[model samples]
Structure formats: structure tokens, C-alpha cells
Target: MPKTNWKRNLYILMVCQFFVMAAMTMIIPFLPLYLQELGVTDPQSVSRWAGIIFGANFLTAFLFSPLWGKLADRHGRKLMLLRSGFGMAIVITLTGFATGPWSLLFLRLLNGSISGFIPAAITLISMTTPKERTGYALGMLQAGAVAGGICGPLFGGVLADLIGFRMVFYVTGLTILITAVAVLFFVKEDQQKKEEIVKTNTIEDFKKIVSTSPILSLFIVFFIVQCALIGINPLLSLYVQDLTTSQNVAFFAGLAMSVMGFANMSASPFLGKLSDKRGTQFVLLISLLFAAIITLPQAFVETYWQLLIFRFLLGLCLGGLLPSINSLIRHLAPEGMESRTFGYSNSFMYLGTMLGPIAGGWLTSVAGIRSLFIASSILLLINVLIVKYNVVPAMSKRNTSTSSKKKSVANL
Candidate 1:
């Protein structure tokens, strides 16, 4: 790789992430309505089927992400990117033609199986970019993703009104197809094949990840954070309704959801740079601590504005968490196993996405919506202690061991 080519690759990949993420989420706001169009007339059945369709992607992604990662390691990250990008582009475009809910459900599952472009992009950049620049690059990459997430719904909503939901899927498919083509034409990935390791597979990769304490800790942190954050999503609108008397409840709910994403996008690049300077462990600990502290206030908010403020601050802290985790993983990964490690991390993320809402929905029914926020805060705090006691000390020992080895090498 050229000295400056990594920068170009990062920029292209960031743009690609934004469009792909936007397209992936474009259907979300209108999904229930779309389901109704598919002949699901009963209210209860629509609700049940909507949950199933929404979760199907995450479920399949959780199972397949590691497989893609292992293949990425063996073949090349670019191949996996092309594979997922083109695969999803076609599958999602065809989603516009689903004759019924079951067919749409099948497409969603297929999309999840082919969903690894973002993770592949992460692995590619981690391999190509300088270590000093990794945090900033990954942070910017995260920004692209969040920015897409924030914009996608609004875009989808307006487009749905104008062109209809089916057309929106068509446009989304086009967007992905164009982005995938851009990646093929412009992105520079000089993926050198690693020396073959005998008896390598996704199962063995899982075992290796479990045995690696630091990597395992990062994965746990990601899972816990995702579960805590996403678990609130199902209840957010109801919580907003309890706090506000506005007629346009949907607007306020959308505000609550997008504000966190906006703050997250703004904070990610800055936090990434800070992690590069302050050390990732320190940034991770402080971010987790503040995130926990900030989360508690939401459970007690009396007004909608207060909730937004708390959510913004929480997003700032969350902006630090994932990039730092990725940075740590990039450094700790074995010589030829970067994609496999990141792939497993992606699995945990999807797992959280699938499980978080279930847990949150159950908790809300049993203990009320406010209790979910409190529980989220408690979960975050537990993560804080785990980071402080387990992850940070593990890093210290690794650093000490490396230094001692270097000293011995010098003495020789």
C-alpha cells in the first residue's frame, strides 16, 4: 500500500458504509405498513410478523458473520466485500417484489447471511492503515454509519410518501449496487494471502476467540452495551408519549432516536483521536463510566427535552466505546486473524440486536418502561467494572510481557 492510499481507501469505504447503511435501514420505518400491504390484515398478526421479519436479519447475521470473516481471512477482505455488497444489493432490490410476508422474510434472512460489507471494510482498513491512524479512521467510518442511520428513516419516509414503499426499495437497491460498483472500481485492497493454517474453520475460530481474554472482554463489552442501548428502542415511543402531550408523537419519537445518532456521529471521530493519544483503555474506561452515569438520569427525566439531553450525552460516551474496542482488537489480533476476530465481534453485535429488544420488551411488560432505563444503567455499570478489573489489567500484563521480551531480545 502506498503511504497515502490508505487515506483514499478509508474515504471511499466511509462513503460506501453510509449508503449501504442508509439502504439497509430505509425500509425500517415503513416496514409495518409494508407488511399490511402484503395481506397481513390482523393487527396482532402484523405486530408479530413485523417483529419476526425485523429480527430475522440479525439472527442470520449472527450465525453467518463468523463464516464470512473466516473466508475473508483465507481469500481476501475485498472478495468478501464484493460478495456481500453485490449479494445484498440484488436481494434487497428483489425485496421490492415480495408476493407475501414469507417471501420477504426469506429475503431478509438472505440479506443477513450476505451482510458483511461494513465488517469487511473495517478489517480491510485495519490491515491497510497505519496503527497511529487506526482510531481516527475507524471513528470516521463509524460516523459514516451513524449518519446513514440517522438520515435513512427520514429519507425513506419522504420517499415512501412520494414514490411508495416499493419504489424506495428499488432506489435502495440501486444505491447499494452503485456503491458496490464504486468499491470494485476505486477501493484499493492489496490483500496478501496468509500462509495456510491447517484445520481452520469458524468453529475453531470461536474457540480461539473464547481463549483470548482481551478479545473476549471487548466482545462482551460490545454485547452488553448494544443490549443496553438497543433494548430501550422498543419502549422509546411509549416513554416519549408519557412525557409529552404533543399530537405529533411520531416526530418526537423520531427526534429521540435520531438525536443519539447525531451525537454519536459527531463524537466518534473526536473520541477516536483522543483514544489514539490517551490510550484506548483509559478512553474505554472513562467512556463506560460516564455512559453509566449519564444513563441513570434518563430513568428520572420529567420532560422530553431532558431525555434528549441525556441521550445526547450517552451517545457521546458510546461514540468512544466501539472505536476503542475496535482499536484494541486491531492491535491484539493475531498476525493473520484480523477478520476472524472482527467477524466474531460483529456476531456479538447482531446477537445483542436480536436479544436486546426481547429483553427490553419483557422487562417493560413486567416492571414498566422506567425500569428498563434503570436496568440499562446497571448493565453499563457492570461493564465498567469488568473493563476496570479484567480488561485494563489484562492490557497491563500484556504490555509488561512485551516490554520484558523486548529487553531480553536487546540483551541477546
Candidate 2:
């Protein structure tokens, strides 16, 4: 295979990530309303169907992610990206034509089965970029996704109000399709390296990857952090309604959600650069510590504005976590296994995504929405302890051993 320019590819992937993320999230702010429009009249039935349909995608995505990752390892990452990006574009567009809840649910399940574009993009960038620059590249890619996530809801709400939800789906589908086209023309993969497959069995491949201490610990941290990050999502709007007297509850709730994305978008690249200089382990520790501190206040907020502020601050801390984790994974993964390693990691992430909202909703029913925030904060704090004791020590010893070996080689 010919040499490829990774920096150029990174820029292209970032643009694609932005569009793909935006397309995925565009329906979130209005999904329930869409269900109501589709003939689900009873409030209880609407809620139940909404939960099932909304979660169907993640549940299937969690199941299928590792398979896709293994395929990317054997084939190439860009092909997986093309498969997911175009598949999602078509599935989401088909969703616009769903006449009832079941049709929508089925489409969502299909969407999840074909999904993993972002993870594919991450794995591609990790493989292409130099180790020293991995943090920055992944960080910039994250910023793109977060920026899209911030804009997606606002755009969706406006488009839903102006052009209608069905039209919004069409527009989102077009946007994603355009991204797929760009990847087809602009992104190039080194096919020569990916042709060889070391592990044919997916289950054994997953086990082999996770059996290592560093990799296993990173997966645990990723799962817990994602759970904490998304745990409050199901109850965030209700919590806003409780804290505010304003009639525009939806707008405030949306703002509260977007503000965190905004902060995360702004902080990701900076934190990525910091990780490059200071070490990913150091950056991960600080992010988790600050994220826990910031998250605690949201549990006690008396007003919506207070909650938004704390959430934004929490986003700043979140900005560092995923990039640090990805960078570490890139550093630790064995040669030619990067995609499969990330595939398992993405599976853990999807599992957390699938569980967090369900767990949050249950927690809200049992205690209150406030309890969700408290639980998330506690989970993050516990993750900090786990990382400090297990992850940091192992990473430090590895770095020391590597440095000593390099010094001995130089003397010889």
C-alpha cells in the first residue's frame, strides 16, 4: 500500500465525525413527540414505546460493535466507516416513513446493527497517527463529535418546529450521506497491513484483548465514566422543570444539555494537547477528580442556572477522559490489533450507554432525579479510586521499564 498522509486524513475524519454525530442526535430532542405523531396516543404507551424504541439502537449496537471491530481489523477501517455511515443514512431516512412505533423500533434496531462509524473513525485515526500525536488527533476528533452533538439538538428543535420532524430526518439523512461520499473520495486506508487476520474467532479475540491488566482496567474506566456521563440524561429535563419557574422548560433543558457539549468541545483539544505533554495518565486523573467535584454540585443545585453552570464545568472535565483513554489504548494495543482493541472498548461504551439511561430512570422513580446525579458523582469518584490504585501504578511501572530499556540500548 502507498503511504498516506495521516494529518490530512485526521482533518477529513473530523469533518465526517461532526456531520455523523449531528445526524445521529438530531432526533433526540423530539423523539417522543414524533412517537405521538405516529399514533401512540396513550401517555403510558408512548413512554413505554419511547423507551423501547430509543434504547433499541444502543442495545443492538452494543451487541454488534465487537463484530464490526473485528471485521475492520481484517478488512480496513475506512470500509467499516463507509458501511456504517451509509447504512445509518438509509436507516434514519427510512425512519421518516415509519407509520407506527414498531416500524420505528425496527428501524432503530437496524440502525444500531450497522452503527460504529465514530468508533471506526477513532480506530482509523489511532492507527494512522504517530504515537506522540495520538492524543491531539483523537482530542480534535472528539471536539468535532461534541460540537456536532451541541448543535444537533438545537438544529433538530428548530427544524422540527419549522420544517417538521419527518423533514428533519430527511435533512439529517442527506447530511450523513454527504459525509459518506466525502469519506469515499477523501479518506484512504493502508490496505496492505489489514489483510492479515491473527484471530478468526471474535469471542476469543475479545477475551485476549481484555485479559491484559492495562487494557481491562481502561475498559472498566470507560464503562463507568460513560455510565456517569449519561446517567442523568433521562431525568435532566424533569430536573430542569423542578428547578425553574420559567415556562420555556424545554429551551432551558436543551440549553443545559448543550452547554456541557459546548464546554467539552472547547476543552477537548486543549486537554488533548496537555495529555500529549503531561502524559495521558496524569490528564485522566485530573479530569476524573474535577469531574467528580463538579458533578456533586448538580445534585444540590437550587436553580436551573446553577445546574447548567455545574454541568458545563463537568463537561470541561469530561473533555479529557475519552481522549486520554483512547490515547492510552493506542499506546497499549499490540501491533495490528488496534481496531479490534477499540472494538471491545466501544462495546463496553455501548453497554454503558444502553444501561445508563435505564438505570437513571429507575433511580429517579425510586428516589428522585437528584439521586441520579448523586449516584453518577459517586460512580465517578469510585472510578478515580480505581484508576489511582490500579491504572496509574501499572502505567508508571511500564513507563519506567520502557525508559530503562531505551537507556540500556543507547549505552550498548
Which candidate number maximizes lDDT? 1
> What TM-score goes with each of the models?
0.97, 0.97
The sequence of per-residue lDDT tens digits that candidate 1 reaches over residues 45-91 is 99899999999999999999888888888888888989989998899
Candidate 2 residue 238 Cα shift, in angstroms, is 0.9
**What does each candidate score in C-alpha RMSD?**
1.3, 1.5
Report lDDT (CA) for all predictions.
0.90, 0.89
Q: Which stretches of candidate 2 lie over 4 Å from their true place?
A: 1-4, 194-196
Q: After superposition, how far is residue 340 of candidate 1 from its true place, in Å?
A: 1.0
